[model samples]
Target: MLLGFQDRLFGLTGSGISVESGLATFRGAEGLWNGYRLEDVATPEAWDADPELVWRFYSMRRRETMAVQPNAAHRTLAAFEKRLGDRFYLCTQNVDDLHERAGSQRLHHMHGTLFQSRCVLCGRTFADSGLYERPDSMPKCSNCGGVVRPQIV
Candidate 1:
């Protein structure tokens, strides 16, 4: 018996796969969990309580993520996708663009992405590559003048 395309080829990845690319996995012994608490930056309440801190945190992350490049494993996966074409499917839990940068177009980002921002009020999302140099420089929603937040899940 043979399986269909969707069932025949599948790829799933997470932060661990990109850890080799110099990105932190946030779950290992040296993960960010040791240095920062989720309550301080990962929650909506935290954002409301101190948006500056949140912005700073994300700004730092954006800077860090932008500095790194996709690793061999990432490139390999992308090549595999090109070879498999529509038969290949990828799902990632990472917020970085290593996979995308690696050239994988048939992929789904399960945890959202770091380079995208969403407007809190209008709920519009746009691609962002610029580092938020300062909290004050954070971009605002053009549609509703609302605060823009990272589009990560």
Candidate 2:
């Protein structure tokens, strides 16, 4: 009897919960990610061959991420957390901060984050400085000249 009650008392959510936060759900139809397949921008080989190109791609994504806002789904989850107390857990696959902005105190980003950048040489991750409007020739890693890459999965 206790086990049955516990099973019905827990709340489980997947990427769908975050989809309501105005974030692009990758691997879905009309996803914001396209062009230059993952092979060209998401692998060790790609980083080794062309770090600048990879940085550029991630930088563009960061800029776009900054422009979006949390949607109703994100807001609803936050509200649920308020009511569920400690029984609610949110797991998001998206890198955007929509869930955070939506007031979700208990959440996890399994993939990674889009608003943060990591040093290619030192592997140090830090928040983006909101300095993405410079020319292509500009924007080098603050810690190292190795170029900053988005900390995405």
Candidate 3:
């Protein structure tokens, strides 16, 4: 549908965006590196092996992300998108929604976002931002009564 545009501007972002906003990177010595392993929290197999642990990690991430704001780089990309309109597109590897917070309307998250979840049963995805401190408090899918897992990729 965007084939009509003669000019296009594409921006790609990664962990730098999160780091610039004070959201610790997983590989950082001060962050998840201290307590978790990617094999235990980042893979689908990891999620299947220990859902509660994965949930805890992701919940902590959501809380941390909610506390921070987008950095200058995010704002710059957003501004460029605003000026260029539909001619601009942004693809981000970070799961956080800093790009959206910075006013970027045309963007895609290459990695799944921390704010969305999908049912384990039917794969119906939906918006969710609340933190679950325990397995009992975890969200249940309204569509099929299955456990809703985070969309983190």
List the candidates ranked by TM-score, beginning with the highest: 3, 1, 2
What global local distance difference test value does model 3 have?
Answer: 0.85
Q: What is the lDDT of every predicted structure here?
A: 0.81, 0.66, 0.85
Query: Which ten contiguous residues of candidate 1 have the minimum total lDDT?
Result: 26-35
Best by TM-score: 3
Which lDDT tens digits does candidate 3 get at residues 1-153? 233447788888888777979987766764353367767787889888988888888898899999999999999889888778988999989899889999998888887999999998999999999898797888889998998899877
CA error at residue 44 for candidate 1, angstroms: 1.9
Question: Model 2, 6-63: lDDT tens per residue?
Answer: 3323344555655554444554563324567656866678877876666666666666
Candidate 1 vs candidate 2, TM-score winner = 1
lDDT of 1 by residue, 91-120 (tens): 998889999998999999997888899998
Model 3 regions more than 4 Å off: 1-7, 30-34
Give residue 90's lDDT in candidate 1 (0 to 100): 91
| Candidate topping lDDT | 3
